[model samples]
Target: MRTQIHSHLQDNQCLELFILEGDASRIRELSHLLNRNIKTVYSKLVSLPHE
Candidate 1:
């Protein structure tokens, strides 16, 4: 799932904002929309490069 999202983000730059912000609410919203677990989303977020 992390790989999938990362690939998607790499393909579309806009998605990077969500990861860059590191906002829990936005993460939760994305998780819900993607039907992915919040923990999984959170884990992916932490793995993102820091600005």
Candidate 2:
């Protein structure tokens, strides 16, 4: 179950990274661009592997 959740979270982070097109600034800007809570994004990012 933990692995499954981790996989899902990693997938989400990948999707976010793709959407940002490798742009660090735009990735950081996602909070305002997508109107999502930044902490949520940050948490997922930290949970994922570091490539």
Candidate 3:
């Protein structure tokens, strides 16, 4: 599943997924949506080392 999802992440790469309400269902639904749209899903990691 991860491989398939990552494959489609090239066109629409999103960089955040905040499940503050702790809803797994939402994530799953989002995953499905992303796949349906062939969009990339991104982890909520909001910082990079200064170059």
Candidate 4:
């Protein structure tokens, strides 16, 4: 897991990035949860080719 946080003191805002790996279904479920949260400004899912 890797993450990064950015804060804007002037606007009192924060941005976050979370990189996750696992089953596609599980990831989609988590994405839905985040999107439902008002705090989530944006969310994206990226899949890499695997054997």
Candidate 5:
């Protein structure tokens, strides 16, 4: 897994990145919980095609 954070020009805001791997079900669950937060400005979930 990888994570990154950067300061936003507005100063009051910032950007965050989280790369998660493992069971798809757990990932989706975690992503859902994160998106439910009122502080999350934007969120997206992307998965690679199954091999």
Candidate 6:
């Protein structure tokens, strides 16, 4: 997951770009990227778009 997130971040670089790409459910992608469960990631996210 960390590998995937790093790859994605390296490609996106900007949070807005990452969000616009629609690859995630907001910054929870960070948690998701870290191999976190979807529910936990969602719970940690406040529905705000982030990098």
Point to the candidate with the largest lDDT. Answer: 5
Better of 4 and 5 by TM-score: 5
On the 0 to 100 scale, the lDDT of residue 3 in model 6 is 21
Among all candidates shown, the one with the greatest TM-score: 5
1-51: candidate 1 lDDT, tens digit per residue: 233332344443323233335566776676566546432443333445456
Candidate 4 per-residue lDDT, tens place, 1-51, comes to 555566664466666666766687887898799889997777777777766
- Backbone Cα, N, C clashes tallied per candidate: 0, 0, 1, 0, 0, 0
Against the reference, the lDDT scores of all candidates come to 0.45, 0.42, 0.42, 0.73, 0.81, 0.38
Record all residue pairs in model 3 with backbone atoms less than 3 Å apart, i.e. clashing: 12-40
Cα lDDT of model 6 by residue, 1-51, tens digit: 222222333443422212223445554556466446442222233344456
Per-candidate TM-score against the hidden true structure: 0.30, 0.24, 0.34, 0.63, 0.72, 0.19
* Candidate 6 global lDDT: 0.38
Flag regions of model 5 displaced more than 4 Å: 3-9
Residue pairs clashing, model 4: none
List runs of model 3 lying over 4 Å from the truth.
1-21, 38-51
Ranking by TM-score: 5, 4, 3, 1, 2, 6
How many times do residue backbones clash in model 4? 0
Worst 10 residues of 4 by lDDT: 1-10
Evaluation by TM-score, superior candidate among 1 and 6: 1
lDDT of 2 by residue, 1-51 (tens): 122223335554633333223555555665455457653544333223337
Please say which candidate is ahead in lDDT: 1 or 2.
1
Ranking by lDDT: 5, 4, 1, 3, 2, 6
In model 3, state the lDDT of residue 1.
22
